[model samples]
Target: MASPVKLYVYDLSNGIARQMSLQLTGRQIDGIWHTSVVVFGKEIFYGQGISITNPGRSHHGRPLQIIDMGETALDEQTFTEYLHEIRQHYTADKYHLLDFNCNSFTNDCVGFLTGGSIPAWIKDLPTDFLSTPFGAALRPTIDAMYRRPTPGQIPAPSPRDPQSASSLLQSVANRAAGSSSTNGYLPTPAATPLQATASVASPLQLCTNPHTLNSLFRTHRAVTVFFTSQTCPPCKMVEPVFERLAEDKASEGVAFAKVDMGVGLGGEVARAWNVRVTPTFLFFLDGNKVHELKGVDAPELRTQVDLLIYQAFPPHPHTSLNLSSIRSISLDPILFPQVPAFQTAQSKLDGFIDASSSMDAKQKAKCKQTLASPVIPFLQSRFATKINPNIPQSRVHAVCSEWNKVTATLVDALPTAELFPIVDMWRLAILDEAVANWCATGSASGSSPIHMLLDKAVSAIASSDTTAVPRNFLLTTLRMLANGFSHVTLARTLIDGRSAATPNKTASTRQNLTSVLVATLLHTDAPVRTAAASVAFNVAAHCQKPLIDAQRNGRRGVSVKIDDAEGDWEVEMVSAVVEAIGRETQSEDVVHRLTASLAFILHLSPYYEVQLKPLLDVLQARVILLAKWKGGNGGLGEQGLSKKDVRRLVEEVARNLCP
Candidate 1:
């Protein structure tokens, strides 16, 4: 066995990843990363490089998989097969490992991959179900695997769909933390008393990256993924709640992940799930299919998960105490494409659009009718138009009213931020061809018709008015621009040094635009702040900067904030902003608004995650910052130390950034 190596990962959700490169050789790298954190721990993480840097991708990737290859006659063969044939070349590897106590897990997988044709008696039960061969075969193996006890030191039965991974992980973390700090070896996971709100649904897998997604599937069980982008306003709305839930249950065997779909991670994944909107949530169970819940801030969705879990693990099972072991199979074959089908919402927009001039007059007429379905009016009746699509822009400007009306009329199934089709429309509307004709007369007096249409969308979102317009609509536009490189061919002649003109925003430009939009979104009023909170799940989409600067400057950066000094005020605005950025960023980006924004997010993150990795980085940085507030980098510690006390030291850092 390779000597067990413990690699501790700090939080680097922000721009800090820009320069990070995490590489591993056969025997030297063993690690753990805490994404939803801002605090520090004692574990040390080393890489061949200076740091881990990943420029955010256009689309988010899959979750971190935890595959356990239980004991078997050919355990090493099976394990090696999985690595060599099943999971190869998949990058962005936060984790990958082989588990020796996976007897139950392996047999279950064999059953699934072999199409569930295992013996009838062992057909449907979990491997842990006693009185069954599969279960009995692995009992000894389960005994050897490390496990934690509850207060009374009781070992958990076995791994299954965890109700609260956050809480579960917290227990392990606390114990591990305690032992590691003093002696460096955690005891074991406990059979923790199930303690949590009844409605906290277990998270499922949802990564947009194909390689990562594929790799994750090969490793983990019961996972949930939050796939979002800067263009997805609804993703933002649903983020905080998801993060809180994930944080609350991290140790419970459940993993909550946020993937940037814009990076081309999941290719055809969005389409497979019929993901017409942003902030889509997909759940998985040991590679076998689970469920998908769309939209953000959804009360109905939570109910669905609650029902599903009950079905999977009934409170009272009268059927059989010795549940049979069903083959562990994979549902991914049906869920994703090999390289990821990079279908844009535009692809789903066939026939309804007038992109062709070759259609017969009748076909054109039908297309127009299809585009302007009366259904639009029917749908809009339920959701009154806050911004009329008719103010005159492009065909889509007129068409958006129809789409918006229908979507609004129906139940909001996903976060407003992640509605890709809507984002595409917004993107199209802003094109010069779409908006050129409608502008009363500014940049497009003589411009094409599309330019005029875009103006309306731009004008509406840019307005100080934060009413019925979903935040996703605006964020989508920004995301389109931030990751706009994919459509670089769409660029018009460069007119200025700061901004480039383009027919449409593509995945490449998202990075550049993410920061600006984040700032713009933050600058709104109180109601807007509340609106942000309602859909704050967007943070799961991955668009935050630092909360404070590192320059020992007077203050932190000016991150775009959701204005919430009133109402749920801090809940969405102040707190959401802080959580969004965390404490990771470039040295420069770390200052001013970016830094301030990060500080705010950590302060607002659920208390459980307050001391998470991202926050910890800042805490560590502040330790140095305070040591030299007046002394410059701790050389003359006491002098600057007296200038500001410890608690005040941290606050001083925050005040400077926020101010």
Candidate 2:
């Protein structure tokens, strides 16, 4: 049977709790009460500290309500671990009467267990109470009273006790601190137990053996060792401060560690590092010992550690350049020849909408009745026919125009599920036109009506709840734009400042397009990754083509003039493309697109040498290794590109560029 999760609410005052509510809100309420969650029949509560108490034994009156929070995914062990982590963060020092309190803890537990938060009404009670004049006046007294521990409350478990919850919590905390040992401190039984509540200390791995210590130096970007003995007075004084530094710099990829020289293997490791002093510090970069310090100098230790991190991973210095080849590229919407089936769908949709809008009260009622059944199904059949490739261009154009009109009307009218099929059908039609070479760049004067309609539809779908619109539909539409629409055209439209009539609007539209494409690159879906990579490839290829041509024609000094308004469009484009490539290097489905993108960057290397070095640096080793691999010679797999083809391309690019 599934474990039951219940929220036990209690009254926090003497007399009837309803009296206090009546005075505060002019209505009878259950009373101002503390809350706890009872999971598996054990009442767990968070206060000044986490504690367990007998059910209904506390001064806080009987629970006013027990909210059933449904079944939990957590088993006993996982639930214990969950509570341990909570204890680390929701410690006595961190608790606040108004903000971080029992209600907050309950909300967190419920969210973790069931993926659903506690009711807003219950969670917001404190805030609501505090907002009132009576609440504000009594805040000081209430806070002081809340901080006191109730009699007979069970103390938080001890970390020294092997079977206790604190030990479990400490083991978890030590891992975050970078310590790998189950017995984190020195194996000496006399060693003082580290407090469980001291989670703010930097992740310091307690090194018991040389192999573990050696691994830390190799795995981390940088490692700092705090060599100290239990007997050293100064070392003991500065230990907490050093821990604080470790915690602060943990995310910066620096591993902080401590070796207790008073005991066992730590003493041996300290001697190996030539530690003559009781407290010594060693800093390593890329597995090489780079710096050392002695004594309890906290400030110097912090400074040297900061310097080590900076040296390990220096910031990228972006270079600016203006390439005439990229400037000459066209920015226009790719317009495809209309399809007959699309026109039919559009015509039918227009008539239905017109009929619905123009109908009298009774007629409208009849139209509404038919909207889902006949009207929608008929539109779906008509739209699906647009995917037929045998249709003539002229007929296709007429159909596409009609379909575009119908889609615009259906954007707000149809449910997301119904609208997704139509949008996907439209995408397939665009993809078909792209394959046929019928889609070509149009005038840069204004946005394409079809593009605008599709964009509107996408915006509406994206803004809706995830349950309403399927993720695949969104990915497919994005993929369609990436494959069918030329990035060169889009980039040119964005950078072209000559059209002064509506620059702001033009820029906004271009930015929206760029934002969507960039965001799509980070999606977890493999198909979405492949499609987004294709879009990045197009953008990179277009930007690089001009530079390649300029170099080929021997016009080394020829530069394209860009207005300050265009700013770093070239840089941003390259960054986005490079980022996409970096993210998808290991993705099997996107190998072709990744290689194509890299090839463009390699081709443009001479023109944007300084700016493109980082891209080269990242891909150099992987490309060389992949190029040398003699993989199976298969024709295109499901992703439509052979591994052999990708390998050859990477080799060709590397051979020409790296040399």
Candidate 3:
């Protein structure tokens, strides 16, 4: 279902990373969806997502969570945003196992967990968004565990190795092993137990217990003490506010601890500080009182209080630490920073990516070479920080948005089949990320620009020059479109509350679209057939009901499923075609289309599997249905045809069958 339709590639590479990505995107017979197969060099990185139930409850002696995502999803969206979030808490130097959605550890993640809510301000949310929190929490935990190398994963070369080949190499290896000093987790070298006291101390601080200080500093300055608490509502509000100042504005060596003064209040430490006010602000020098903010809550209170404390104790030594508690404080929330326009950058890029036929052989060769080195690598790095905390949400949006623009230029500029393999790969990658982002944020999101991406996919498929575009890319695009159409149909019904599912304004628009989708089911090209089969299945499965129902009720509402008494016409058509595909599976062309089409189904669905059943059964059902529509297989005076005529037609067709 991915752009290139990599089936045997998994068996080809042993690289751990590739193994991991493949595992995330594909599925095994046991029903696990392979999100990614991460390969670095020849060592493939892969992990199977197992769902753990009653997490602490043990069956044999192992901890577990249920691998719910393995069940199946209609499709996996681009996991770039997920990856960005993961990269921030952890690191991805080389050894990251990315799910196809770009999540490094999204084994069992799904709709609710992956994000499918509208903005918080919207009053009513779709009921489908119910499962987000459990999924979101599980994802982070999986990533944490995934980040932990296999028990005996060969140790990364030590950072302290003086003769190491490259500090850069060590950094890369350290990142692969999750040894990030900057991320929240501490970087502990192998074989070294954590020394809590020494570890918590500032780089220059000694491991001595409280009340101990260097004799050199003791003679120069006095230590200041400040008190705070975690539970105190006001205390919680001002915690970051105070930590920022303790390291910055204390103007002298400040030592502070947040006392728990709510349910468990007034501990021994409270008595020592002479607790008075709820947020009793204090200032001390040399363990002696200097001043007190009986009540200090003003704009930039840290500045006002520190100056007063300093004036009271002029003999103290130290300068402000200039700490940042928040990224940026705004006087007015309405006026925020703006994202820069990328028009100029786009123009430069556009010149390079112009249409394929216009370019010479030299240019085509350059385009192909650049696709791997620059375009592909960029996509890899761009999504590499799937879990990066450093990148802001807006910046992330900007990056994905720019990608769409760049891809548009590429599609507009280049148009050849040699580029087809990579083109479709990028196409699926972009759409996957887009869907993931859309579900996660409840906003229509994407890793690459959606419009540009569709343009490229469509262009490749429509290319008249056989050599200009890969037939595979065209077919793949068709499959993705089918699935995408179904997704949007569901989204519209659930998220937008709309009635129409397909492209046309009229319900009968199916006649035109259905023909287009079905033509590809018998595609001449192998990969083309594969791709076409997928899209045709999804589109027909979801949108064909109107045609089928129209045959019965003449545009009136028909109750097919229990709760969908008022459902649309397309559902019936999809159900009918599904029935059709199942019946025709014995034919090689039909079976290929039918089986490959399952990739776009709500994976693991009962109806999904039936989409590929042998043709005899389906042909039998079709004859019955046609008899009902035409009165009988043999024409009657009023009730119409009888079954005998239909049976005769089928026998003739079957006699001439390829088999």
Candidate 4:
């Protein structure tokens, strides 16, 4: 089901910016815009990091504009997972007012949910403000105010002004009605004293001693020093330029520093570097001075800074490719959240508990008691509605608590083979956010019930023949794992191999997941194949999301370093998925997902040419896909390879593997 998405737009200045922007920034700005994506009863915004609150309940209060961003096809669970994945990139420390702020987050979220962007005026306000001369002059002060700190704080909105949307609107109307009385003039807001700067050293450092300068050179990959004198007119002209460049290149591993030649120890440092003139720029690479430029030539200085960055950090070859199609791939994790009939699931599980000879009388009684608990009834009513905006969160926690207790008892007493029904019930319950979070984070003792249950299933599959494992049990396990992606923590636990209970069992968890994944991908049942494809797609999406984000950042001349742990399973997963693709000639949906997974693991991947490339070539992946493309329905009528979207995806994967 689709949910309507709304963009709540607030002005940081409340009503002050509209009135006083021209006087302050010399521009007729509407307001200092702030935006949040309001959907699923949550106002998701980025400020002190990505946060969620009841709609219109944030500290920013009511929005000045409520733009309808249309609808999102994602259900609450899937969308929550998407947010969990994206939250890593939008941390509090990474927030920037001009570059990556609240509006930036809204734009990204709106694009993900509705495939649309926020209105241009709200997003372009920063650029417009910076274009003005006054705004340009105030850029340093603005950066200092918004820059990340050991203890950074965005100034609180004024309490003297009413915070409600209606009150703010009324004040604006009152001002508009009385415009003629004051010749259309509005009072400028009183200036507040600037707060102390951040405890963390700025990228634009000030060095008064050789030791400090030498330490900076050793720490950063590339360093640029601006040697200036207070008495030099050219030095004054370029100081602001140097500071702006420092702000821009700070994230790129290049440090910028200013040395005042007329200040303490400045003369000694100048002579140490053999600087003959003020406004001299010295470029250092790997702690060695590589290039020098003199005078206040701003354009040349900019060029030299970029050149030094390039020399220190060469561009990844994948960044140069026009792989827009790959970049356009959806980063949303595929989840299977179908809830089964509670009565039916309970009856089936009771049958298993009754038939189990391994279970003693006490165990059987306890299991049946758990089945009769309020947890099942609560879940039945919880997912009864398509979108229950008013579902009591307290009720959710209560049900989750009951289930957690029962799960711990069942896992200890019952056999692994008979626990599919219990696992299935937990999977259905996980559709609720509270249950998902509980299962993801695990118990207070730091044990993951979901991980343990899934591990037992994997072991069962591994020990028994594929044909011997019950079809329903295998399907239930696959679906259970797929639904585990609902919470970001569980998603990480599954992919990154970090077990809550056994942190050292990282390799075991990863191997168990892959073992089950690879086994199920080739299962005889069509439903099992479909379920496996969804699981594969989720893992593949996880693998490629960081790479895709890096590619996007690269386009903006900023590089985001992905963790090595992110790609640890890429090569192995790709091999398993490609082999599954060759075998998946039956289901169109399965084939499409498999090919999409292949494209994801291959596209913009750092190991493409080095590792995955050779493996794909050896597998004859291009030939295999080409055969599928040619054989199916005369290239258009085939089931798996005939559809336009499927054909396009296969072609993309084939092209990626082309020698």
Going through the candidates in the order shown, the clash numbers are 172, 14, 93, 0
Candidate 2 lDDT score at position 181: 16
What would the TM-scores of all predictions be? 0.22, 0.34, 0.29, 0.64
The best candidate by lDDT is 4
lDDT of 3 by residue, 1-659 (tens): 32211100111112332222212211111111122211111111122112112222222122112222222222233332322222322222212221211122222122212222112111111111111222222333323433344411323333532222223223322332331112122222233221211111211111011222222123223333334443456754654465565444322434433333321222434565576555666544545556665343634457544554445333201112121211011111011111112233333333544544666667555554554444444444444436523434354445444444444445555554333443344444433333334322321122223333344444444554433445644554554444344233222222212112223323222333343444444445655554555555545334333223332232211112223322322333344444544334223344433422322221212232223223324445344333332443321223532344333333222232101
Candidate 4 weakest ten by summed lDDT: 177-186
Error of 1 at 490 (Å): 25
By descending TM-score, how would the candidates be arranged? 4, 2, 3, 1
Please identify model 4 stretches exceeding 4 Å from their true place.
1-233, 250-290, 311-316, 319-324, 357-362, 386-395, 443-446, 500-508, 553-568, 632-640
C-alpha root-mean-square deviation, candidate 1: 26.8
Which model is ahead, 2 or 4, in terms of lDDT? 4
Q: For every candidate structure, what is the RMSD over all alpha carbons to the true structure, in angstroms?
A: 26.8, 21.8, 27.7, 17.8
Model 4, range 1-659, lDDT digits (tens) per residue?
78999999877665676654543433456776788899988887776556777777676767788989999897888667656545544555545556556776677677667667788787677657755444554555445545535213323324532233224333432221111211111122233311211212245655554655765665567899999876899887887788778767766768887777755456778999999798899999988999999987999999999999888876766566666555666877677777777788788878877787767888788767766877666766677566555556566666666666667767666666667777888777665656665554452234666777766666678788876777777888888888777655456556644444355653455667788888888999999989889888887776566546646665333332444654556777888887887776577788778877887777666666677778888888887777667666322234436677777767766775555
lDDT, candidate 2, 558-656, per-residue tens? 223334433344445545654564455346546556556655554444434454555446645344434333332221223322465555555554444
Leading candidate by TM-score: 4
lDDT per residue for candidate 1 within 1-659, as digits (tens), equals: 32111111222122221111110000111122221100111221111101121211101122122222122333334433332222211111211111211121223233322212212222222211322222333333333222322111223434741223223333423322221112121122233212121111323333433433544455445456666675778876776677665644443344555565553334345665555567777776666557777777567545544443443333221122221111011111110001111233424434323444444566545434543464234224322445444333335345544544333321133233334354444333333322311211222212322222223334455554434445555444443332221111122111101211344533122222333334444434332233232222223212221222211122111222333322232233443345423322212112223323343343322321323434445445444433333444432333432322333423454443232
- Per-residue error for 244 in candidate 4, Å, reads 1.9
